[model samples]
Target: MLPDALFSLTALLYVAATASFARYLAAPADGMDGAKVAEEGRRDVRLGTGLLAGAGVFHAAHILVFSLVLAVCPVEGIHFPLSVVAMLTVLFFVVLRGRFRIDAAGAVVAPFALSALLASRFVGMNAAPSTQVRSALLPFHVAFNLFGIALFSLACAAAGLYLVQERLLKRKQIFGLFKRLPPLDALDRAEHRFLLAGFPLLTLGILSGTAWAQKVEQGGLSDLLRAGFGWATWLTFAAVLLLRAAAGWRGRRAAWGTIAGFASSLVVLAIYLGRGGPGGHS
Candidate 1:
């Protein structure tokens, strides 16, 4: 009963925050002066950020209560992982939004966070494995992957904004929404840094997953496909990094690579929760 109520409350908070962020992105149809727009934008962003921060607090409480109710570790299964990833992503965004000057990007972050939270309640619940199938490495694997995915989510959002801003600049269209977003170069650097930071955690998670898979002897075409996506996500980001350093791939090329890598990562995650675990059902 308590869990249900908390979940409901968390959903409400996220929905409210998402709404606030959407308002934050609305441009004045009247062509307001630059100073007036910046002032209004900052007000909306602060309210949205405060609401998101409140939602994150409730999100953490939900996880704690859930772990207690289920008598399971918070990191053990699908629902918590999905929830935690969204919460962490929110926390990270709130902290860095000012430094990165990416307040408008909250349009992407808030909605995704809400959807992931909803997915936790509806989709990930039934996918929990039975006790016998549980592995010690599972918590470690999920924790690291959750962190990696959170970073990847941010990287993907930044890369997407970078692409949009880049296109606008090349066409010489600026001011209005473009003026409100983070600078193009900052978004690119933040995307690259996020990718760099997350790659090692993803690598570790994959290694642990492999060990667990071997221990359980879970093999077949489904497992192979899941593993393939995991590997593909890793290699795609790796190529992005490598090409960036060696071949100077930035702007559209690098943005595309990051988006491709993020899509592969999402497939890997979707396969996990949408189906089941490593031994996903056909």
Candidate 2:
């Protein structure tokens, strides 16, 4: 219950920050003409960043509490996995903030929004069954999968934003929205880096999952179908990577591929959870 309260508060703060970031992006400073608007935008961005940072700190604290609770009690259901995903997603964006102008475009807020929505689903859902596994490799497998999803989810959000920004640019419809977005090239570059990071991690996750399944005699035809879906997601990304290399697939198509792949992966996760995973929480 404490964790839930902390999570909800963090979510509300994030929603507020998202709004502010949107405002900052919509209004950038021009020399003399838009000076006042730009100043206000800057203030909004600063405030938004501060709020996001606060939310992140509180979010980490909540997770720490959850970790302690799980250590003493049984870790239940989708909440833990979803919480881990949300926390890591925010962490990844925070790291990228140091290197990119992503803050200017409100990219940080979107992932939090996604996380919040996903987490909230547990409000009414049944708890996941806790299963004990005694293997050194299990932790690594879980870590890789969670972090991979975090990276890909960010890429998905950026791709969505890129598509919108690209379409607006192509149509010569520069307005408030245009002012708020980063240059298209930068978004493309960031998305590429995210994909590069995510694909390898995802491969590790798939390999680890297969190994775990095999150890438990779970590698039958059903496992094959699940693996196939996982591969399908990977192939989608591979195709996007290939097109990016040869045909220069830059914007919307790339984003769409990321979304598709992530969605498929989520479905696979749902299946695993529904079936009661061999040792991990089902």
lDDT of each: 0.83, 0.68
TM-score of each: 0.93, 0.83
Q: Candidate 1 lDDT, tens digit per residue, 1-282? A: 887788788888888888887776666525777778788888877888888888888888888898899876777765677788898888888888777777777878888889988888776676656565587888888888889999999999999999999988998877776767778988998888889988998999899988988988877776777789999998999999999999999878999999999999989887787666544453
**Residue lDDT tens for model 2, 142-209:** 66777887788777767777888889989997766666666677777777788889989888988887
Error of 1 at 67 (Å): 2.3
Runs with alpha carbons beyond 4 Å of true place in candidate 2: 1-5, 25-38, 72-78, 105-134, 219-225, 276-282
What global local distance difference test value does model 1 have?
0.83
What's model 1's lDDT at 258?
94
